[model samples]
Target: MKNNFYDQNIHYQFPETFWWGSAASGPQTEGAALIDGRKQSIWDYWYSVEPERFHNRVGPEHTSDFYHRFKEDIKLMKETGHNSFRTSIQWSRLIPDGFGEVNEKAVAFYNSVIDEMLANDIEPFVNLYHFDMPMCMQEKGGWESREVVDGFVNYAETCFRLFGGRVKYWFTFNEPIVPVEAGYLYNLHYPNVTDFKRAATVTHHTIVAHARAVEAFKKLNLAGKIGIILNLTPSYPRSQESGDVAAAHISNLFFNRSFLDPVTKGEYPSDLVELLKERNLLPAVEAGDMEVIRNNPVDLLGVNYYQPRRVKARKEPEPENAPFMPEHLFDPYIMPGRKINPHRGWEICEEVIYDIMVDLRDHYGNIPFFISENGMGVEGEEKFRNEEVVIEDDYRIEFVKEHLKWVHKGIQEGANCLGYHIWTFMDNWSWTNSYKNRYGLVEVDLKNGLKRTIKKSGRWYKQLAVNNGF
Candidate 1:
């Protein structure tokens, strides 16, 4: 009976209230890294010290210039048929000291951006954190310190009191697990230190901080829904063997459930706790931390899906003296003949989106969620730009259409997914990638006074939003 809602019609339409737009962050899009009382974030500090780490040596200061041209960009958002959009308020920009008075210019900038978006009838979904930790906070031990957690709660409560009236959707963090893995476990991001204990501590404290923020939001009686954005990479096993299946489950526990469970279920999975305890790697926690997590569950969820993870049982034992890590429990498995996005070197597995929604329905009580970020990243997109000042991104069109079909299927089957937003609104600096891969429906031409032209995919997305589906 639930599936009957999806008839045999060739054209699939969505509910009239569905959200349509894209997602981006302030540091990645706004270029005023120094102006308007904006101090240094970890990205700014890292780039200044080691410029070579960034792609083409392009730093965060050279973003799409959205800081000054936000009015024009907001117009572009409306032209592209966006009913809702997601962006972050930079912590470094909002409070230069990370615990000081709010900057008036920063306040004015955010107020104008939110007001402009509202004037254009585009709902502004404001996120509090997006990997842009203030340099001052990092100086005092970043997420590893309980003091930093308290500072974060204060920041969140201030934002709620300041802007909760206008913004209906607020997320505590975007892809919260990435910092744990990238900054602590791997050397991919800033403060590149590979320590299992530190990684575990950071991961634990971050989730606890999110729960605390939710607690504060509810306590303040903020007139909005609050949640955290998590990047869910559906883990697949190499085969049906118990060892392989167990490896996949472990991988999911670390990458997906590390944040998902605490925010939604209020406690860490016992199996994960047992594994960490066996290795003496359990993070430091206080007496009432569990209660804080237990009492406050998110009202909504923001899911960022890009690629599925394929893992298998480890083949070799770890060196006796090697640093302990998650890979000790599982290894990567690259399947043969898997569909690939050659442009980005990531697998193109659209069905995983449907599988994720099904898991949420059957296992997680079907909590309300949305695809906050999903889009193809293609390098050398300029090669596709044609004579009419349009970037013909047909591959991106195919990518989005294929994913939406699975989303439609999940919604028809009664999954509580509310809407879909792409990975980005326009091409912006992507961390170390630094605009190497373009994932925008509208192209930002830096060579032409930072000119923005709607790509072919942007026009088609407008049509799909107008039709409610394709």
Candidate 2:
């Protein structure tokens, strides 16, 4: 009844040329896990043992079935007006055992997926890791062991040699800090060891693995850009008091700058290093490790912005013998009237995205980057279906519009942001959350054979992609 095709894409129009697509990890979307010689990722093993931990008792193996239906999915990508898409080659699927002979079926599957996207004019942005480590690797100390680091390098090298010509954009890891905080500190992920020393060690080895992968890519003179994805939470303080400000700074240093500095600036923040030294928590660094990190920086950066971290100065000294943590330096404080996503409970402060971009521009040399993942999830979205049977997710449309405006502002004020991709392409199985929270333009019906339907937001995204903004 109305012509609103270019309504959102205009006004805050993006650059004439930029990436337009969504991001998905292999474990979340590929369901033929045990079909093609694919071994168990930690999520697989964890789900098998503790299905109660996962929402609805749905496991990683029960996703959108991308493994068997990527061709049709690529057609949907074209319908949604995507020029580029991002996904990972599952480490567990590729190597299956982490450090052993490669699975030829896994290689062929990825090859076909990449080719299918290209055949449909959808460029693929490939990431090496997305929190789905082979269970065998986890059993062998995971990221804490140098052996895993070597295994990671060999895997990366193999990927380069196999798919470098077709895939030009590569990321070493996605959200490396999450596993450190969840598994080691908060005990939210597997091998839940609440040891600060081991967490620090894992963080160091992750950095090493990323740097070595970059080194491998550069040494081969590959034809692609290699980088890492970081879910950057801009730390906000309640007041401008020096103490409160310092607390926020400490939070940022410990979380954001921990991996950001070494990947982009070639080293960790001096203050953080000193703080670790004072705590006797500095990770054991080997000869040439720092050199590798310092010498090899990423060619691109992936920014996954979901929410901001708000903190204030600690009111009292932390209890003695309380295990060491970044939280000990600051206290969580809920801002009085911050906006929030009703379904997900995450605060919706779109301005923080601009804050991160500005900081990167002013402090980190304005590196080429993109908004890799940003979206809102609403529970039970099928209730919104109109007479046409399409899920009318207008709230999602508004959520994306608000964020894109900030992206436009960043681009205007001098942040070298290149693109924006939503958190997902379809409603698929999230690791622990499963499908409880729907964050896709396309809704997947789990009760009915995983039926896929394009929501209203999907059509809007098609227009947004065609218009290159919105």
Candidate 3:
């Protein structure tokens, strides 16, 4: 394999249609929570309700302040060679109550941002939700209740009708599994509740909501594409042993195919459904829900690949017949001598990106795809500051380059991927972890009132974008 790091000629130039961009969410980067008639999201409520849970007790107010500084930030986007950008429209900002009259200020703010991106030759790919539910909606049962699904569909339709023409690519939700696991099952997000039943229900409802949004988009006959963003964690076995392979298969079925099957293949993985049914934990579904999911398939898929899971057969007995855990059938085991990202404790298996794309091509058909989010999070990146206080983050550059190689491999092997957008464009607020995990190409100086500085990786990305290869 030719190393693209230095061998520029051997590195394949990206397609002319490639989208060079970065991604941020409304809640993560857009501060000024209460400004311009914006209401409170679950993050806002979480900060108020449990301040201690956040890193350094720094609440949502301490984000990059993109709400007020978008005009300036758009300049930064242009400078970074971002011909396209992805951002979410905050539901609370638009419909303060989660489902009612739209806030004019919020609408105007988003319009300004979208128009600015277009004016600057940047395509705006708008995502509907990014894990920030309105406080009002969370109190009313969040995704666990059917009402939230209707509310989300309404919110999605509103955005589509409002900005469908300008924004060519519309994503229904960003990593819908994260909210289901973090909020309802694992207690990492707002309205944190550790109930498997609720988690299962939320997962089911989120898929339904995504389908409903797709259905709505089809009805609108918009001249754009709509899809859902999934964090695809490819599962690998510890060995070729049947038990290990089975464990890995079940793990893939639980995480990857759980959503992929329905969205792409238009049906849930039978093994996963059977496992849940055997434990009597299958989410209650109305007769028409399955039809909605099966009928409205995605036009594209945004894959966020960060890590892979290595699994082994479960040795321990089930916990007193408790609700079914994927671990009950498969245990996550670290592969020996695998590369690890010591900064974030995530195993670094770059080949997983290629494998995932291949799997999608083989199982789910060759749907248009994008590497919507892929980046490393380093802790205390400020320590790299030199005499000039500039961040020289070479590790992040290497991280992106290695991943891009596999992306190139996937493209060469017939994966219908369209583009790649790093996990973030700049450092901003991350839920629970807050700003501690810096995954941005640009370093944000929180102490200096959220100042931005393009890191070494950002400069490298700019060149890559300009040259269409490293």
- The TM-scores, one per candidate, come to 0.97, 0.98, 0.96
Per-residue CA lDDT of candidate 3, range 370-464, in tens? 99999999998998876777788898888888998988999989999899898789998888788888998788887887788888778788777
Cα lDDT of model 1 by residue, 156-233, tens digit: 888888888899999999998899889999999988989999999999899888999999999887678999899999
Evaluate model 2: give its TM-score: 0.98
Q: Which pairs, if any, clash in model 3?
A: none
Q: What digit string (tens of lDDT, one per residue) describes model 2 on residues 1-470?
A: 54456564267677888888999989899898887788898888998899899888988885889998888788888888788999999888888888878999999999999999999989899999988888998888899989999999999999999899999999999999999988899988887789888999999999999999999999998777999999999888889999899999999998899999999999999999998898899999999999999999999999999999999999888667888988888999899988988788999998889999999999999999999999998898989999998999989999889889889999999899999999889998887888999998888888888888888988989988776765
The regions of model 2 sitting more than 4 angstroms off are 1-9
Predicted model with the maximum lDDT: 1
Which sequence of candidate numbers ranks them by lDDT, best first?
A: 1, 2, 3
TM-score for candidate 1, please give it: 0.97
User: How far is each candidate from the true structure, as Cα RMSD in Å?
Assistant: 3.5, 1.9, 2.8
Task: Check candidate 1 and list the clashing pairs.
Answer: none
